[model samples]
Target: MKDRLLERLPGTRTATDEVRGAAAPVGLVPRVSGFYQEWITEMKKVTWPGRKDTLSSTAVVIVVVLIIVAFLGLVDFALGRITQSILSF
Candidate 1:
């Protein structure tokens, strides 16, 4: 898998040479750590929504879901009544 990955990277490693000699991990650990730090810094810069915004969004979602559930329940009840009436007839 390592050999295949190294082969895929352009201008990095070729297939002929010994895999250990071919694969030289230079500054990989520091680069990954820097990436994490940069990601955290970017996240801190984001304009996060306030508590009011969060509450309103949550309320809207709950109301919409409740309306849909009520609608489905009414449809199910009507269908059940019609089915029972037809079966009885």
Candidate 2:
């Protein structure tokens, strides 16, 4: 995998070579820039969610969280009441 990735970068050495006492990192700048270049290329291919889809997904998440919070609040109140009743004896 490292070799294949290095092949894509055209001119940089694998970081393994640097660890193995290869000379100065002569290709650091090119390597970093190439990584970002690949990032932009891949990002351009993404199917980003539209505004409506994003809003609907966020609403679902909020509703689920609220339901869970309410459920947990009831459970906590029940436990507190049980504990108080036991201690008051």
* Candidate maximizing TM-score: 2
Which parts of model 1 have CA positions greater than 4 angstroms off? Answer: 1-42
Model 1 clash tally, residue pairs: 0
User: What is the alpha-carbon lDDT for the whole of candidate 1?
Assistant: 0.87
Expressed as tens digits, the lDDT of each residue in 1-89 for candidate 1 is 98778788878756454555744446989779878998999999999999999999999999999999999999999999999999998
- Model 2 agreement with the true structure over 1-89: per-residue lDDT tens digits: 97687667956767676799835435989778878998999999999999999999999999999999999999999999999999999
Worst 10 residues of 2 by lDDT: 17-26
- lDDT of each model, Cα atoms only? 0.87, 0.89
lDDT at position 46, candidate 1:
98
List clashing residue pairs in candidate 2: none
